[model samples]
Target: MVISNKALRFIIATFVICLPFISMANPEKDTTIVQTVVAHEGAEASHEAHAEPTDVKSKVKAFIKHHVLDSHEFSFFQDDETGVHYGFSLPIIIYDNGFQIFSSSKFEHGEAVAESNGNFYKINHHDGKIYKTDAAGTITEDEKSGHPTNVRPLDLSITKSVLSILIAAVLMFFIFTGLAKSYAKNNGIASGAGRIFEPVVLFIRDEIAIPNIGEKHYKKYMSYLLTIFFFILFLNIFGLMPFGINVTGNLTITFSLAILTFLITNLTANKNYWGHIFWMPGVPKPMRIVLAPIELLGVVIKPFSLMIRLYANIFAGHIVLMSIIGLMFIFKSWIGSSLSFGLSFALSILEILVAFLQAYIFTLLSALYFGMAVEEHHHEEAHH
Candidate 1:
């Protein structure tokens, strides 16, 4: 299962090169485009049309936004003519007056209102938020702010992002457990999928954990470091897939991960770690007092940076890659379209590399923080 570097690169390159042609051959994409064109014309003829127009740039922007947002259902495709969506709906659990559980399909992809316990609810297409409404699904808006005045129930629905996280967690469990079994069965040697992931596991330990956190303390944090590295790695890879699962790109997800690191680092800090922060050994009393608050702020800033770094990189990458691919539709000419495709292909490969890089960076910084927290200082040894 362990692929050589050269072979991996070659496979990625081949896939990139073939992607455009493969997409061109897809009849569903072509059908969707044709339907969009037809729908656009129909909308132009009607004065009260509310459907999305088929302007090339507008459609592209809308598509990107849709992909970026979490949805109530998994939409693989849609037939405009038949007004049918090819997707499965997730359960919608809301607490307004009381608990109301229903299928997302009851909303009919946000085209219709769903009634539960004699209360009607409608999803706002612009923000993807569900709102309480009348039987007609009338969303009252304030004239001054132009914002909805409808009541919003507590939504505890399993959105696309939430579902993706559950999937990733389950996948990691099986993968690592299987790898452990392989090691035990093969006399401490990894077999099957373990062979592929064994090198990466070693890299994190040897290069990241041991170097940053000393060997004496690295083992204590190895489980956490390994878990986070692979967790982020798998989520990043999932975001790149065509399933539109952007778990890592979600700010909430990144923020949660950062919070975990923050809690672990501060909770496990040795006396020396806090001592240097609140009262430095080699510094003046006045300076120590001044630096204490700054060091405390650093604690919050570290995890904040971690959250933003992962979220921004992954989110921006998706936007840029999707925008480049969107250029193909905008450029109708062969030369322009070909150029767009070529740039997209290259960016796609780069995105795969970033998927791993972001995971590594997050893990490395975490290990470094752990190292700093547990580091011991000897005044006599330091003076010598």
Candidate 2:
């Protein structure tokens, strides 16, 4: 039953090694939120912020003056003779009559259009006359463009986050199912795919579950731990790839994971765990009354912390990497560009390790909660 000093020390050392990586990842994400707020404030201070730019910002802009327009969308060669690449990075929805595009690149609203009866109509930005287009991309008479209809395109493309989660889920199903089959075929022992997974599963069973929850109750909690460990681990790794999707970077996904942990913790709690929470045996009656509220609050806060920790770390890392890349575009200088490339490269390597470490921490905490819930209390009198 005793945990050796050496074993305890190793646990401490492992945490020390991984803590900074997780912590750094969070601040980078938080800073972006702060900066966005500040930028919003700055924009509010200027009354003429809506005016068209009288000056060009970069060499590319100076070269392409003619092609660019005051509107967010354009379809011609620039003043500098740079031809428009309609095929590259085209917007999903374009308001051709209104002279605007719903492009992530252009971002700001340049013009507005109206629609009616499954057709789109817009007042031309130049002369303010209405034009119409049908569902099949055909221009129609102005009389037909008077009904309210959806002007958006039916692109139905999956966002990066959704696609990433789907890919991660499929990969986990394949790898773990293969491991399970490998173990089944090898006389209850593992081989092949199982060999890679067996050690980690055994560690969770032998070290985490049995020691914390006791031998009798450990098996009941094993499947949940294994599933969580692998799920988070898979998603984290996928978030680090080049075309990586930040599934855990999403607040909703992280919150759902935390909610599951919360449910399991409460549902699996033995009589003793609840008894201690509501009424401590040795504590004063007056203190127990006050402590009851604190204990109850702890239940909610624990899962909330789990949600924020995972979400913040993943979200922050991605934002930092993207912000550094954004800086390369903003600076337009070799020094800034080269530094951004180097820092992004180094941070990316660190993020890969972090993807594993955060998954382990989340799993470890969840297992600890499960252990607390199912742990059996020994009778002091029987021991004597």
Candidate 3:
């Protein structure tokens, strides 16, 4: 028997999303192998708190400096003996006025500084220690740490989430264009690849679009339903990739989608939907007034729920995966690595499922909105 294109596409989409996380399952080994080796050797060589060896190992020193230093100009590195982790070379401070420095190296060990004022300052640090050097070549003392820049976006900047959005867009274009061609060649007859996608498209058409918008009006809304369904599906799949950046992980994207739904729903809402929301014909005058504000709030809250649901689910998944991978470095043992591999594998599988589920939910909810907007109560009661 021939496998359905829908099933094949679903499987391929799942793989695309899960591949990145599966590949990232063993990040601990790549990140901390040197730290583990040094720890083992140090245990044999010295017993004192700070007596490991002052030939001055880079990793130990950099790690220490990062935790202990407190100035804005100075920083420390992790100091991998294998040189696998690159050291910092960029100036600690970048300014177009006289100079600028943006280091692209993976900084695990070393020290650097930028001097400004009488006191030495630390750059790139955790706790109180310095992590890298500044332009002036000075290290910071405790009680002198400068606040570092938090790279995470606070207000939906493009720099923060553009790549994720772009990835989603590109993936959507490829899949949908292929789908469109498949659809046309098959002459809407569901041949070849169209067979795979037809059911899903049909599902949206029959269950979502027709029921919600009513068959008479559903045709007008088909393009919007198709766009929302595929856009969400593409983003959901992209979120699952190992190297994946979560587009839906950001509230901004979700909020934007919600706003679009809100606009379309309200713009297209028939007389009955609004009447039911603001005034009930059977209800007492006093009761209608009391319910009006609550009903109005629901309109806003409905889209708000849409935004939060998608953002929270996607964000939580990414954070959980990152944290689990981070644990591998913290464990410092074979058991940790082994357990991480298994857990990561399982989670990757689950993420695949979540990708499809989220897409379905978004599409389903959107359809429901469209249905509410276009529903006609008088027409429904005519038979009765």
Candidate 4:
């Protein structure tokens, strides 16, 4: 049983050499370490996936589109941590079999279904339209059009645009009413806020209404001209505010304004105006018939142009301005971000001027149309 020192030393060396391999071969410990590493990496990836947008361009485009589109709620901003939106909800009024009225918050930012009078409704995120859906909030889409097949109720909701319009209207009423009272109080001299706005009012009456609509007839249309000018100006200014209200940029709103102009022009047209359009006094009999339809077509084209011009200009301005602002976040560098911020600020200032310019142009064109409709033609005097 006497062991040699050489054999004992050999055994010790062999054990020392194999210790690392034995540890490496242990499956349970290695598996636990591997699982821990994998779980850490997976969690980091998931956090990143949720925290940041994968495609910056797509995010920017979506933000711009959302800026220009009307929504049921006035969302100021969203919290990054909680993912909760900060804004008040407007009322949603829909007429199906009967009126179904509810607060827009019931939709939970288009993530939930709203029930009323035994009917269920859901908001289509794609178009922001409310559609009748089942309790599960299932939406059936048409295969060809890709639009929802669910029946849409008659929407009479006071959307963001509608709310902005109402605000502008109330603001305009108070402003002008105060101005009128000031004029009456101060012996026809406007005081206070009236003093500030009087010059603009006189400019509209003198430069726009009288020149285009004639001094004799301008008085009757001055009230409407002033109302529209300030109404549009206020809405455009509102759009540029941080509140994200794009009332004037809405097509339907512009269309409504154009319709008002159309009605006023044609309804107040003189007999001479209709005569010039249907049967030109100066043209040959055969040629007059040819020109008549074309002239009548011009009537419809005029208002259509007004609607398109206002809508396109305001809508495009908002998109461009917002896109520039979005570039600041994408750049992620001091110099590039500063440049983007500078450009955004300059564009915002220019947008303020555009807001006024658009209002002026709309008012000017509307007055010009009135001038054409009420213009007197002295054919007898011209013949003499």
Candidate 5:
């Protein structure tokens, strides 16, 4: 029977499954594994027909991990039964001992090892990393851990995640640039396309930037705040789609963004900022010395929290949402599947709110940090 379901079901399933395949090397032998779900009651199957998908348990875990991790290609969709992928292949570039560039299609959807420059390299399916091996393509296993033990190449391929980042960047460039030009044409007043973004830009300026940083210094830092706000918002919205673009969900991405905030905070800091950390003017010398270490440590802690907060929220949300949708396939029954799907639909809507919320939180906190950095201290008038 066809596995097709309702449009909502299809969307949830599609969202749950359209993960990228890094590439996996199977043995020369091909296994023909089939799963049959009998629809009607028969003489032989009079009691009940219970059919489970092939390797359900392991496949489920791999399915989730595949969606979460980065891959060398962009897989739009797939057919689980036939294992047919309907996505375009991306270019794969590796630097082992020398540079080797080839299309990921060379792997034939991980059915075969890719040969580049007379070098045989296979994909470690277990971890989604490429490994160098002999012509036989033997992947050694570590005794301590059942993981693959093979030398890896410097993989610098344009994967789905990387492509998504570029897409967001290009989109932002055209959008903001157009808005800026429209404002210029209208004699500093928002016009045409600028009307759409004008409210948000003003909100950030009036609500976020001005309130957080004083009016004098707010303009100087407006560019960074607006850029980050939209940059993260685009990524968070992109991730909600079935395309599997988890740019902000990655810790590396979040850490880099946090580092940017940290640098701007400390680098642009006025003397008052350092004075508070090193030696508070009003506080006694002994107390100032005692507080100095804690204040300095707080500087590091601020950015670290920023990194973990964005990463943890986005990453955890994806996992929870994916796991809920995955339960529908596992249930395979009308009632259970319906309940699982209902929950998924609710969470999906909530995720939309979260997408906007995360962007705001990041921007708000960043503006607050800017305020602290550029804040000026007042001293009492000289006493007689």
Candidate 6:
């Protein structure tokens, strides 16, 4: 009964979110207005570039690069004429001798410097990184290296990525808690929203968890697997939204997740697992020595592969999709513009599949690693 209530609430919340789009009496006219504004501004910016394909290509590349990277502030959309942003700005927190707290809006969408606590900082809009600069805000770059010669503080700002994580965490809490309550109320039978998650939970347990980690030990690791699976799955789905956060696509995020798996797999591993890593029991002494390094190297490679696989796939997808969409503006010709638009639409659909597939693969591999760690080599010991 409570589950049903929660489900209704969720539906209502979704409706509230959709109300704006639905309330629009003439979306076509609104779109036409926006497009008319965009074309007017874009033509002004690229008037000289209209004759030069190289100039257009450079502009497109820069635009796509900017789109894929993480940013301090969250921006849904911007107006070309008045330079108005249609999203909430994030808080900027930096530790430079003392704490500096300010809004990212202080930078005015990266066109200005933000000063707080007598310290001035500038966003390298070129790369979306923050750096400390003088009051005059001068960024000196070394001729040898393109990096700026400026001090950088420890930034603990709640960026779009951080906000997305917090959002996902809260969303999961509500969902799973409601699902749990519903399941409890039904006395083992799935009820309300539980019916939705029930199938996915069972699929993970049956096809991924139990099959990979064995029935006995699977339950022990289910918490970790489920947590990661849902967290990553939520992140993947969130990236598909126009929220300006590419959490999973960020290497730091994938790396952190991979490290967690690595630590859990190695730390919880049984004696048998280490025995296989350091020295193979059945193998000859000389062979074991040669194989030991390879086995150890494999440990590092496993997590590295996990990180790279997720980061590369998501990052590349975002880049390619955006680049193609950017090309629609560059290639004004009907044929080229249509081709780019079609490719972008097709890839957007593919990205949805990839979003789910990556979550599955990461969970599957983590479970496999867990199984290997807990597996007993009794038969091998007997043979030796």
TM-score for each predicted model, relative to the true structure: 0.84, 0.60, 0.60, 0.85, 0.81, 0.84
Candidate 3: where is the Cα deviation over 4 Å?
1-160, 190-195, 379-384
Tens-digit lDDT track for model 3 on 37-118? 5777766543443343333243334433332222222222333575353222323333323433333121223233334343
Candidate with maximal TM-score: 4
Give every collision pair in model 5.
none
In candidate 3, where is summed lDDT lowest over 10 consecutive residues?
151-160
lDDT of each: 0.88, 0.63, 0.62, 0.87, 0.82, 0.84
Off by over 4 Å in 2: 1-160, 331-335, 379-384
Model 6 per-residue lDDT tens digits across residues 1-384:
356888999998887555334422355765675586567766666354223223445667765665678888888987866969889889999999888998999998887988897888998755688899989778777668767888878999998899999999998888888888887888877676657777888889999999888888999899888889889989988887765569999999999999999999999899999999998898888999999999999999999999999999999988888888887766545555766788889999999999989999999999999999998776665577
**Clashes, model 5:** 0
**Candidate 6: worst-modelled 10 consecutive residues by lDDT:** 46-55
lDDT of 1: 0.88
- Clashing residue pairs in all predictions, respectively, total 0, 8, 51, 0, 0, 0
Candidate 4 versus the native: TM-score?
0.85
Q: Give candidates' CA RMSD values in order.
A: 8.5, 14.6, 12.8, 17.5, 10.8, 12.3
- Per-residue lDDT, model 3, residue 348, is 78
Q: Please estimate how well model 3 matches the true structure, expressed as its whole-model Cα lDDT.
A: 0.62
Candidate 4: the clashing residue pairs are none
Report the C-alpha lDDT of model 1 over 1-384, residue by residue, as the tens digit: 899999999998887666555443446866687687677666565432345755667678888988888899988777868978787899999998889999999999989999998999999987788999999999877779767899988999988888887888898888889999998998998888767889999999999999999989999899999999999999999888876778889898999999999999999999998988888788867988999999989989999999999999999999999999998987655655887989999998999999999999999999999999999887842453
TM-score of 2: 0.60
Give the Cα error of residue 93 in candidate 1, in Å: 1.8
Error (Å) of candidate 6 at residue 257 is 0.4
For 77-188, candidate 4 gives per-residue lDDT tens digits of 9886798999999999999998999999999988899999989999887688999999998988887887899999999999999999899999888878898998888889
Give the local distance difference test score of model 4: 0.87
lDDT of 5: 0.82
The digit string of per-residue lDDT tens for model 5 on 196-302 reads 87899999999999999998899989999999999999999999988667888999899999999999999999998998899877776798889999999999999
The deviation in Å at residue 298 for candidate 3 is 0.5
